[model samples]
Target chain A: MLAAERRDHLLELLARQGKVVAKDVAADLGISEDSVRRDLRDLAAEGLCQRVYGGALPVSPAVADYAARQTVTPDGKRKVASVAAGLVRPGGAVILDGGTTALAVAHALPKELSCTVITHSPTIAAALLDHPRAELFLLGGRVFKHSAVTCGAAAVEAAQNVSADLCLLGVTGVHPEVGLTTGDAEEAAMKRALSARAADTYILASSEKLGTASRFRVLPWEKVSGVITDADAHHPVVEQVKALGVEVLTAS
Target chain B: MLAAERRDHLLELLARQGKVVAKDVAADLGISEDSVRRDLRDLAAEGLCQRVYGGALPVSPAVADYAARQTVTPDGKRKVASVAAGLVRPGGAVILDGGTTALAVAHALPKELSCTVITHSPTIAAALLDHPRAELFLLGGRVFKHSAVTCGAAAVEAAQNVSADLCLLGVTGVHPEVGLTTGDAEEAAMKRALSARAADTYILASSEKLGTASRFRVLPWEKVSGVITDADAHHPVVEQVKALGVEVLTAS
Candidate 1:
């Protein structure tokens, strides 16, 4: 096969399986592993995919620049955010994650709802300014500009000071096997720290994030209490998640 | 004089003197003390001025809504912010307060300069998103919607975590006699806490705030390192502040 054709085929496999193993792809195409690795490296260099140890994973489309990500599954983000916002019981403390989806969740929260919101995102904190009754806490740390969120030792240590009833965790990708993931390692660590401070954590997955894998893993299936998503209800991956004994909360 | 005339005259005196003593106003106008008190009450009810123990003080225009205050003293805020921004030595840590002037300071900061910024204001933190090299820390606390900053006991506790090289404090009022003040008691406490965390704290005083007096006292004159202002050079308040052994940094 031509190199361009093989690269297209690799992308198709990644979309379908959420990852491409070099050994499997080489055998399936009757090509050498070296050729497959070279293709993967080229793709990674172009920012099309994340090159892994033995293969490649898709880079998260959700981590695009703020303006660019606004067009990435916006309606689906709103639907998923609506469901995530509903999880907040009045008067409860919630740990909110930072991302476009989480920003959507901030917009989706009721104006009169009097819950305490704790987050490390300045953007989220600024969005909640006009919220009449909701009390917000912005955790301090070194900022991660791409996500407009705070991470690092300071943020993690600050997270330990609060006990939250629920955490709405936003990640770039959610796969049945690879679990929840994002594009940055420090952000993944911060999310883990936030989850530990909460009694229950729920995944906020819009349609595009499903069946995709990013560079860093966040939580395993057992770590999250539920998944709030707007993905197709009948999708097999949704069924696969359900089969793992996890509650799947679907948005309309 | 007519009641309308008397009230207007009272406003003028308050503007010139930063406060109105009922006894003095009554004596000056040849009116009953009761009549003067009634007029001051009417003015306070209209939000025209803040009624103090024995008279009234001019209300802070800085405490108005963000949009309304945008048109108020913009040039002064920018000039004050320019001088305030210059105080941030490259590679040093700065504690930034809330309000439009501080937002201006965030804007005035050179994007190429690298520094660590700690703040309790989401608006200031949001403004710094485009700053390429400044590291920001947003202290977690209950959101103060009026000023788009954070305060309360949680915020005061959060202030103790870090030490900064300088603090640029924003307040509604800065009077030599009243010391430093703001509209809300909790916000005043938060500012005091922030001042303690920094080695040198400079007051961000636009022209409007130079001789004003708000309800809550923030800090005494002895506590602050200097005052940055765009108030007239020969303005008695500026001269008075300078005479108190406080460094008066003027922004052209």
Candidate 2:
């Protein structure tokens, strides 16, 4: 197929699935991964798609723009958020990552359950206001407008000081081969730093993010305690993740 | 129904509907409005609900908690917030105080407008994620969980470094006798410090707060540039505020 044809096909896949992997696209189209990458780069330059580590996701996830990401698979995110919120033990210190999904988790928290929530996302901290029993600690740093979260050195320093029982990390991509990833390098560093301080960490991703990859690698699968998603436990990706020894939780 | 049972029913209504007016509850339950008010007052004392002008809202807003306040008179808050947002000029640096009303102002901001918003409320910063043109700066300090904003020495020091063109201050009470007030002393101090750094400061309060009094004073009338509310421009309270040499803006 012509490069233009391949690009069009990739765009179609992204429109349908919310994400596209270069390797998968290459294999399906009988083309080399290099050719798929080149197509993705062109699409990203045109503001059509965002190029990730081993694939390309919808532009919204690639840029860490919160509002844009909110419209993609919102119900799925809510489900995942519900399951993630269930993972927090009462009275534990929970570290929440910044993203729309994490905001959902914040909303799903039981209003009467007491806990201390530390987060860099202003949105998540605000959502926790409804939980009368939550003690919120907002990490301070440079405000990243795109994601509405704090980043930079100050944020990392603050995360290092927190020793939370759980961390619900929101990421753009969760690939079996490439691991957990996000859009920005600084944000990735901040997430890693937060995970380091937590006793347990779980990635909250809707099924749309399965098999996808982003530019910045946040954590290897081994570091994550589990994967919480909206997909059924019997789903292929869920099975694959469980096969790796990470617990997989699906929201009913 | 017994008094305890009636109070339990009221709490249930507040939980489901977010708010319950005294008159309506009395009519529905075959009781006098005075009796309903007594029940609401009892609930308020027990920290189960917050008593507003003619009704009781969920506990969050009643207790100056950030999340609960979001559901109280949302339409009225939106009206006040729109007028407050209109006061901000393009390209100017604005300081926003932490509160449900200020969060509304952040949401009311035009998507295409370019400005710098410095805030201690992570919720406000997160709301600005929809405004692609605006730059956000989140001040760091001890997080005040009740209001979901940062307070204390660090937040005050950060506010001092910023010279904003305008500051939209949100408070719990706006009284002729007491001026602007809030629930916590540290938060009041933080608001005062933020106002000190701004060229013009406006208080965004709903009409229900017109004659209310809180525990801590934030600013005197002379220090404030204006009062924006959902009340009519010709209301006695508006006249009182205007007589103090402060501009009073009402929603149309």
Candidate 3:
């Protein structure tokens, strides 16, 4: 693993265990104990963890902070988020699906925009808490601990009642014929309900997400109104999606 | 256990297991198989569970609804809820701590009153999902599944940044000297932050909480502005709290 990915995994493990031992980190990540200690020291400097006798413990419950998420896909997601946010207008009610990309759209939303954002993702709801003018409708259902989102029938039913202005989706896998898909079956059901409620739809993705397929299908390419991605979104791939009458927003 | 408690526990087991045999329920709850079958039949009649071949199972996910929480402290919480909701003004920003009493207050809120509500409880956030005019902010933190609330540094920091007009607190335990207390240390830290950031703080607690103390201390009694509770809060024990200069609101 790259040093960055190792640090991210270390942080995730510490979050789950509430502390981490240098020995365990070394064994788990196959890094040297000295290197593990160095990583812990680096994280401790940022106040993300506190180095102790042998392992590191969280300095604050703030370990759940989205600072880690912010470090990911900064530019690409910002552009995609801008495109998705533009689709929303004041007084509009919309559904936001869970994923780093959907969270990106939420992160870039103008604080002055007033709208109702319904979402299953706890992280997305957290992202919107500081949005002074936005109204948030968080769906309730069985909590999926790993993804920090809600799923199951309750989430689907709650989403069904929202005849929304738009649905800003985070597509995990997309194919011309297969449409959009994800690895989680329950989230697929939630995405379909969210998609069905909206009058218009947009999928925020990174270039790498294109041409990849996960196990569960969410929607077909024909169901999406547009695709917003980064500048290097693969020329031929963008052309193929555009051929289907779907608008494409490419950020430079 | 009484037949009612047996039925509830049986339903809880079925909800978790997806199915339950009368023999297993009998062994688990230490009851006769005949009584277990009777309890299952009773729950089936209530539309809470379905009788399967040789067992019972949850009819729907809704069987695990908030109604289960209501059976916990029905009268005392309802009495406290009346006074608590009265403290909230229309068009105000209110902070709700995660507790049965605070949840009760959310349920008792006037349907048409418009306000901004900040909460750490998924249950409270879910309750407000269909409230057309209520603006909701759900704190993001490590979710504590048992309590259905988020806690840790993120939730605490989010509460700190919000200058709410009022904060409604729930007490697991209370003492005239020790103030409000809770069972969880992280939740207490969050409650302290929520209390510190609010202009007015009200502890809406049942009379049963008056003399008890929990492991985590939230605050000293003097910091609280008011205590809203049942009229029977007239016990001299509670009068000692009134003597500390905090106004007390009683539900008639």
Put down candidate 1 lDDT per residue, B134-159, tens digits, no spaces.
88788877788888888888789889
- Candidate 1 has what TM-score? 0.70
A44-132 per-residue lDDT for model 2 (tens digits): 99999877788988876544333344455388988888778888889889999988888877777887999888889887777776677
lDDT at B132 for candidate 2?
Answer: 81
DockQ-based CAPRI category assigned to the predicted complex of candidate 1: incorrect
Candidate 1 Cα lDDT to native: 0.85
Query: Each candidate's TM vs. the true structure?
Result: 0.70, 0.61, 0.44
Q: What is the lDDT of residue A17 in candidate 3?
A: 55
Candidate 3 segments exceeding 4 Å error: A1-252, B1-73, B231-233
Give lDDT for model 2: 0.82
Local accuracy of candidate 3 as per-residue lDDT tens digits, B39-118: 77878898887765566656763454344333233456777887788778999989888766777788778777798887
Which one is best on DockQ?
2
Each prediction's whole-model lDDT (CA): 0.85, 0.82, 0.74
Model 1, residue B165: C-alpha shift (Å):
2.0
Interface RMSD of candidate 2, in Å, is 19.2
What ranges in model 2 sit over 4 Å off?
A1-83, A141-148, A229-252, B1-80, B140-148, B152-162, B205-212, B229-252
lDDT of 3 by residue, A150-219 (tens): 7777557656655787888886776666667888998888788888899988887777777778999988
Docking class of 2: incorrect
Ordered from best to worst lDDT, the candidate numbers read 1, 2, 3
